[model samples]
Target: MEVKRMTDREIVFRLLRYEQANLRNYQNYLAYTKNKDLSAYIARTIPQIEGNIKSLNVLSRKLCGG
Candidate 1:
């Protein structure tokens, strides 16, 4: 088994992708969950995930010079 190290840019891109997927999953869960408490928790968590995605996008742009 071999372990590969990722560059900073690659790591940022991976983080951005992961956050995007997580945001989508959270939204799906929020829509389908019937429990009010869980829904509220998901709602609260969504903003933080969105913020992370936004920040990662900014970082990506900075790295790529777009």
Candidate 2:
């Protein structure tokens, strides 16, 4: 099998997808979490996750000429 390489744009798109999934999963978990401390921690990370997704989206768009 030949090895395949990913371009910077492709890599950024992949990371963007992963971060989107992470945000969805984290939000879902946060909904079910009952503990105050755990919920607070998860809530805090949500903003960071959102930021990552936002940044990744911007990077992906820039690389793709969007």
Candidate 3:
């Protein structure tokens, strides 16, 4: 069997997609949650996820020679 190698740009793109999906899921969960503490936690986490995506995008651009 042959192994396939991944590039830094490809990896960052996949990570960006994953982080975006998680952010969406967290937003939906926050909307449905009734517990104040949990909702607060989820809301706060959403920004962190966004920050991760932002950082990944910057990395991806650099990897792509943009």
Candidate 4:
């Protein structure tokens, strides 16, 4: 199989999609879990996830010239 190059916009889109999926997974973990310690661990990681999203947004805007 041949690999194709992605444009900047496509890269940004994929990055944003990945970030969204991670956040969604964390949300689901929080929703269905009964373990307090695990929930606390997830809560602690929320800030890191938010930071990643912010960084990706900045990179996307820079790439798109928005």
User: Clashes per prediction?
Assistant: 0, 0, 0, 0
Tens digit of per-residue lDDT, candidate 3, span 1-66:
999999877889999999999998999999899999999999889999999999998998899889
Predict model 3's lDDT versus the native.
0.93
Best prediction by lDDT: 1
lDDT of 4 by residue, 1-66 (tens): 999999988987898899889999998998989999999999988778888999999998888888
Model 3, which residues run further than 4 Å from truth?
Answer: none
> For each candidate, what TM-score against the reference?
0.89, 0.91, 0.93, 0.82
Model 2 misplaced stretches (Cα beyond 4 Å): none
The lDDT for every candidate, in the order shown, is 0.95, 0.92, 0.93, 0.90
Count of backbone collisions in candidate 1:
0
Worst 10 residues of 3 by lDDT: 4-13
Sort by TM-score, best first: what order?
A: 3, 2, 1, 4
Instruction: List the candidate 4 regions with Cα displacement exceeding 4 Å.
Output: none
After TM-score superposition, what is the CA distance of residue 35 in candidate 3 from its true location, in Å? 1.2
TM-score of 4: 0.82
lDDT value, residue 52 of candidate 1: 100
Better of 1 and 2 by TM-score: 2
Q: Which pairs clash in model 4?
A: none
